[model samples]
Target: MKIISAGLPRSGSTLVMQMLKILYSDFPLQKVHGYIEPKEGQIRICTYRHPFAAAVSNARIYNDLSDEHLKNSAIYIRKMAKAVDLYTEDGVTLMLRYEDFYLNRKLIVSSLVERYGTKFSDMLVEKALEYSSIERNLERQRVYSDFAHWDSETHIHGGHISEYKGDPTSWRNYVSSSQIQILVSILNPVRLRWGY
Candidate 1:
């Protein structure tokens, strides 16, 4: 099956891509920031994060907390939201949440395999499950320093996850009430659709 993985900038797209690569070693998987037109036999897997968290991460990464930044992030979140809704109707496409993928890798992988008729090894799934922990990724970063820089360092902005308290909602601590209002104003519709 042809697979395309995409998400908003700070979403866990790379991690999902790496995990899928491990699960299906031979399949050619493409990762993109924007939507791709999936061909007849292709399946597009899209990932998304809570808009509040996404907006905060965007600000931190771009180092710009202006209204412009929030507006842009809100727009991207809206676009991905629409994409997920349309893509899922095709039966071949699957929408995965970053939080769910992080907290339940095995179940998500199994569900995707069953729903999409994708082939994967149980043994590889087990190994991937074991390696899904943040500790494992952190260790990988230590051993392969370049892995930290392989994608956007926004995730490990401080060169370490531990520094950010490592919680998805940690963005709450950084984003102000007013700034959150800005995000919510633009994202409320999409956020509600995603059950956020």
Candidate 2:
């Protein structure tokens, strides 16, 4: 089976990938570039909301497909779906909101199993509990880092979602209001749904 473990960098995707790897113990996974290049038969990362990547695509698509553009007043959820489809066409996709897993992990694992079937295993679930047990996820707050170089604003942090109490806002101290808005606009929906 093919597994892609990336989805826009700051979306708590790496933690999910690690948890999956630790849990399944059989995941031959690969991290693909976000829109840099496409490689077949490998799990790819395509964060739907990262500003830099999104900006690049918006520019490219607008430049190329601008002729067929839809009106600005439209909600355009289909466009989002098409983007997801373009990047996430085959195999199993594991794009867990860091906040969701942080707030409630058991539900997340079970839901993933229900949606994706047996791709998620008991051992992986067990290990997630082991790695993220409340205290461990707290340590991750300090494990995160970031940079603002205009082309991209990347924040890298580590922790198991099972450990989080769903308060991803704690990371707010590390970024700016602008950053928070950007992340919230993209993640708040899933985060709230996931209970983080």
Candidate 3:
């Protein structure tokens, strides 16, 4: 089967893709960084995160928290929100939240397997989780610190796992109160929809 892994940038979409790659070793998979119309005969695995945190991460990666950066992040979040709504309404997409994946990977993996109508042994599930664990990814980041270096297998690049505190609200530390207000105001719809 063909699989499309779609999500906003820096929202753990790569992690989801990596896990899926491990679970469905024979399936052809592609990662779409933003919204895309689902294709015929494709399994869509969509992941998303709190808009605030996602914006913060985007800004950090670009080292720009300016108004322009925030505005762009808002735009990306809006597009991702639209994708989420589209996939949810389609009723076939397996929507996974970044927070849930981080907190309970086994549950998320199990859900993915169940949604795909496949069964994986507990050992395989654990292997996928371990392979995609933050520590291993951080090591990859360290080895590939150059911006040009991208790991083909994991689709990870240098500095991909920046300051990941595993707390959704950690975005607050990177931006000012006014910036936070800006994100909240612009992304209120997403927050309400995703329960961020």
Candidate 4:
């Protein structure tokens, strides 16, 4: 079966892809950001983040906090919401939250392995965890330093972890109250649906 890792731009999709690549070494998996038409027998692993956090991350990464960017981000979030909703309804896709990746990675890996009906050694699982750890990816970011130098295999680009504080709510630190209100107004429905 083919495996596809998908999600929004600032979601944990890349991290999911990296871990899947290592844990499912014998299988072929691809990272396709956002939605794609799934094929039969394909395992679609879709990741999602809180919309407010996503908007803050996008703003910081692109250095754009204008109204235009906010509007665009809302549009992107809506599209991702639709994709995730479809994935959820399909019942075959594995829907993962961003917080679970950081807080319960091993469990996520185990669930994926169980769903795929594959057995991997403990050492292999550990290797996948270590290789996809945030620290290692940060080191990769320092080395890459630019989009042109990003690691194609792992998809670790520079500034990938902009201002990570091990807190999902850390987005509040970078954005103003007004911006937060705007984001909340725009994304509250999605937040409610996703339990954010």
lDDT of 2 at 110: 70
| Pairs of residues at least 3 apart in sequence or in different chains that clash in candidate 2 | 4-43, 6-45, 8-47, 23-124
lDDT of each: 0.67, 0.43, 0.79, 0.78
lDDT at 44, model 3: 86
Residues 1-196 of candidate 2 have per-residue lDDT tens digits of: 4566555433444445555455555657554434323455444443333332232223222333221221210113223434444555543454444445655667656755665565655766787766645555445444543121111111223322222233454333334456445445554453344344
lDDT of 2 at 150: 14
How well does candidate 4 match the true structure in TM-score terms?
Answer: 0.90
- Candidate 3 residues lying further than 4 Å off, grouped into runs, are 36-41, 146-148
Error (Å) of candidate 4 at residue 96 is 0.8
What's model 3's lDDT at 188?
83
Encode model 1's per-residue lDDT on 1-196: one tens digit a residue.
6768776656676567667667766667787767677687675777777877776666655556677887787777666666666665656667778777666677668767877877677788877666555666666455434323533421233333434634677877766788888888888887787798
* Candidate 4 RMSD to the real structure: 1.9
Clash-forming residue pairs, model 4: none
Query: Among all windows of ten consecutive residues in candidate 1, which has the lowest summed lDDT?
Result: 153-162
What's each prediction's TM-score?
Answer: 0.77, 0.46, 0.89, 0.90
The full ranking of all candidates by lDDT, starting with the best, is: 3, 4, 1, 2
| Cα distance off (Å), candidate 1, residue 36 | 2.1
Of candidate 3, the 10-residue stretch with the lowest lDDT total is 161-170
Looking at model 4, which ten-residue stretch has the lowest summed lDDT?
158-167
